[model samples]
Target: MAAAHRARHWSFGGVVLVVTAALVAAVLISFSGSVAPRADAAVAAQTWSDEFDGVAGHAPDGAKWTLETGGSGFGNHELQYYTNSTSNAALDGQGHLVITARKNTDAGLGCWYGQCQYTSARLNTARTFTQAYGRFEARIKIPRGQGIWPAFWMLGNDLGTVGWPNSGEIDIMENIGREPNTVHGTVHGPGYSGAGGLGAAYSLPGGRAFADDFHVFAIDWSPNSIVWSVDGTTYKTLTPADTGGKKWVFDHPFFIILNLAVGGDWPGSPDGSTAFPQTMTVDYVRASSSGSAPVARPIRGIGGMCVDVAGASSADRTPIQLHNCTGNAAQQWTVGNDGTVRAFGKCLDVAGGSTADGAIVQLYTCNGTNAQKWTYTAAHDFTNVGANKCLDAKGNSSADGTRLQTWRCTGAAGQKWTLG
Candidate 1:
């Protein structure tokens, strides 16, 4: 759960927390980098776990988890709005917590895109539990699709106060749909996170997709050490030295998080080949202190607010305006590989594909045209490729809902931008 440089894809993950740099508390915890006690040295006690034995169609135990509801993109430019509704997250009596992602353009949840095109759920143990040290594991059957992203991870409980990266994060498992045979485990801290996160991949042998059955994904932790394993097969381990001297921020308490995202930068947007109503069936999740348990980042624009999609809509020509940064999905923008700035699976476009000066800017379907192409230069100006104009907030106003337009580049404050 590291929300660092670039849009996190939930892998360091292609995932994230929505806190901002300006609000970060600068509180760093320096714990001794000594190794945690070895397994033979002490018998770890079982502290907490979820069997998903609740009545079918019911929500998971509220006392043991907190349902995070939002479509803020979670720093990943993800497409789905995580909701508290049982329709998105519920238990099956047979023993499983099913987090489902559905095609729901009518959900009306404000997403990074205008109307949320999809709906899912994200759950965490942030309020119910926090462990400093031990083991965390889960048995899961992941769903498959072009843009589905499923993960089991941990984040520092000090996230709110310290912000991300500094809060530390340990991803036990993260599987993007494209890599059906592989899953990743990673660590994100002060110097390493997002696409730069340090981690490794573990794959099922020979053309096997993990969705075939339930598999145990887990991490054994002790002090500076964290080991990742699949089905009890250890594949990777990490420590302070592995960070190239970056501060080891994982020494404190953390909480668990589980989520299924629909689309984002790393996983790309869902396409025709993708089927809707995908489900991540979690058989069980357990935690015990060997110890204890485990992360937002945002994009800021003119007026110290954020560049946001009006109405969180993805419909063609929706105004891309300035708004009080809510850190929601609407504000999560990604500088795509194709030179397009995207949000909610759509591109920042010059209205009507016009390249003329003073052209209105809006959200539109990515159509590989000059109107959608842009260059974010070293000077922080977003130069529209076709018109050679810069994106400027109207009237140099910082007011929420100020519309944006493309104007002749004049080195104006209204034309400057800072991407996360």
Candidate 2:
């Protein structure tokens, strides 16, 4: 699990100290090859695209989704009552699902505290659309003002068997009215669970509120990695290295969830400035996979530079530099069904398992560890084999003298790595 907090409280030093401590603590948490005989003629590689022509609507086309309602409060001290009713959720003629939050005066619709005062809806696709690896996205306009919490997220359908963080939750978009234009995306799993889970905020370029208009929020889920983007601009990414001691919760199928809640622990209660009963409009939600297939064959003797390596002994850190891939056991990797990469019997962990540059890479045994997971991008950079840092070169150098490193990536050429 990974998390980020609003920087409203701590001073710069205080924040740095806390992050440093977290990195130090991460250092202490020490945490597959296959070839297939192709039966069919090779097909053209699928070009990436975001077309939602076949997506299901409110009723959720198939078993891909289920409605969740009437829980004893979803960790937040919310006022609205949750119900599994189509009346609360429906598709508008404009090709969108409208989940409305309304004041409910009916005494029959009661809450655990007493008579219900409000009603809302939560929809998920755990059964019907559970996917292992794919691109997931939703175009939505959030509700504004204090106390409103609307989210577009994913939860492992294995909750009944695996339980909570172990099952994993990927929050693609979450906005509390108080925060307005700032939308948050995050991943939740064991080890890095709760308030400190893996996540980040993407404020509108000029710092505008998301409630103002519909925006596309998405995550590209590949074997062992996840990348977050807003309107096509990459903001953050998470790989196996970010999972810490937790299992690689993202490897299985996850269903979608969309809900609007009123007030909670994180967003707090509505203040005098808050408006009543705001609304969240969702244009559509889409999921796409890399089309089920075996790993591509490695080009013999054609080495690609390592660019980044994690999990080496501290003494070997400097020498564990990037070199051309020689199809060696060290270079060959297998992305597991559970979205993790396995190689050399260890994980491709990030240095200090951090998202910052100059972080060292160290290897450790896998225990669903986040540090070992990674996301490979079309841009060729390998993000956290566990969480969100991207592979980077020290100071943008292609020179042999330049050190290889991981850094807060800007998608620069020097940070890109390729495999053939």
Listed per candidate, the RMSD to the true structure in angstroms reads: 21.1, 13.1
Best by TM-score: 2
Scored by Cα lDDT, where does model 1 land? 0.76
Clashes of each: 34, 44
Candidate 2, lDDT over the whole model: 0.58
For candidate 2, what is the TM-score?
0.63
Q: What TM-scores do the predictions have?
A: 0.62, 0.63
lDDT of 1 by residue, 1-420 (tens): 222223453322122333211122212222222212222122345777999997899999988877878777877788898888999999988999999999876645788678889999888876667776667999999999898999899888777677777888888998888889999888888778876888788999898999889999998665545768898676775655578888988777777889999888778789999998899999999876542111012446677989998997656789989999887767766553346666654678999877677789998766678898887677778888888898999888889899999999989889988765
Show where candidate 1 strays beyond 4 Å: 1-6, 9-42, 105-107, 291-420
